[model samples]
Target: MLRTVATRTRVGAVRVVQRRNASNVAVQNIESRWSTLSTAEQNTIAKQLEEAQKGDWKSLSLDEKKAAYYIAFGAHGPRAPITKPGHASKVVAGVAGVLAASSALFYAIRLGGQEKPHTISKEWEEATNEYLKSQNSNPISGISSEGYKGTGYVVSK
Candidate 1:
């Protein structure tokens, strides 16, 4: 008997709290004033919505339906844009700046680097082929081969 009384008291307390938190705002103009509502007001409206949805769905007002849809899919929370205006242009400019800087650095290194090796010259490569032929290197299919008409390491212009 004591447990039943305690349970009834808790249920009555919960109902009183729910009633206190329920908003008096009419659902008809909720769409227009939703953004201006305070957080507490919004939570009250949400509670009202929960109670309304627990009953007959066909009895809900059109305004309530629209409010529910907007609350679920509105661009005010996670769906909101994180970037400011002109974000794409800013990103493109950043990428271009990085590309230009890298190109400049590459050209600076190339221009200040050591000269090409002497072995890269056509004359040096031809002399190397002759030396290899004299050394009988790969006699079957290389510099010392018979009728080997292929260019042998002479690639410089």
Candidate 2:
């Protein structure tokens, strides 16, 4: 009988404490009407709430964490902006205007004046071939004399 009475008393005390905590006027009042508070008061309340939430969050299980994450970060609407035909036409016109302006600018700056078509003259080709032939004839430096040219080829019996 003593043990039963003690358990009931403890349960009653816990319920009373819970009711007292739940009856916080500030939390209730802020939920219904928040704009009346001054900036400093709002900041103070925010900090207190944040600290309390930090401790409460640590006790959450994995499923609770995932639920919170999905509620906060999951997308719940259309991924792309809905565009009517008129809006889409306007967008296309804007893009076409940009492209036309860019093409005009490129032609004005790069291809406005042309003096004869570009061509590799015979003299220029001959000069380039001469330079390449000279480079090819020059033996590579840093190779030992024994390792030069035909030294690595095996002689067949």
Candidate 3:
């Protein structure tokens, strides 16, 4: 009987200490929420976390990252200025204007009559060749005609 009384006293003292700790507002709030959750809800949350941990969580490719960002952070609607066919005509007109200006400038330059320098005739070439020949000797050595009236064979010593 005495040992049972002593054990009961110790259990009561432990319960008092636990009650004192549970008096904390933060601890009491967490305890109240946890007590309110059903066993099935907690089990479901645990299963979801376990499945997520099993999934791949490495760095993504550029394409995959862009796709995820666009899906999560897309803007409201179409946000650009619309254009029509007349815009193309404007570009064409600008190009044609440039071509016409260039053609006019070229035509004006051609009509201005630029004189080409005179090229020397073959007579000038013949005189120049003759002058060079007089300055430079004919390098032809001893020779004879078909009638045979010239130097003999150059026999070596």
Model 1 Cα lDDT, one tens digit per residue, 1-23: 99999999999878755553443
Going through the candidates in the order shown, the clash numbers are: 0, 0, 0
Candidate 2 overall lDDT versus native = 0.53
Q: Candidate 3 on 1-157: residue-level lDDT in tens?
A: 9999999999987874554343222222332344455777545433433333343534233333333333234331242235665998999999999999999999999899676432244555455545544555333532322343332332222
Model 1, total clashes: 0
Relative to the unseen true structure, what is the C-alpha lDDT of residue 97 in candidate 2, on a scale of 0 to 100?
100
**Poorly placed runs, candidate 3 (over 4 Å):** 1-84, 119-157
Give the Å shift of residue 104 in candidate 2.
1.0
TM-score of 1: 0.54
lDDT of 1 at 156: 79
TM-score per candidate: 0.54, 0.31, 0.26
Looking at candidate 3, the ten consecutive residues that score lowest on lDDT are: 23-32
Residue 2 lDDT (model 2): 100
lDDT of 3: 0.48
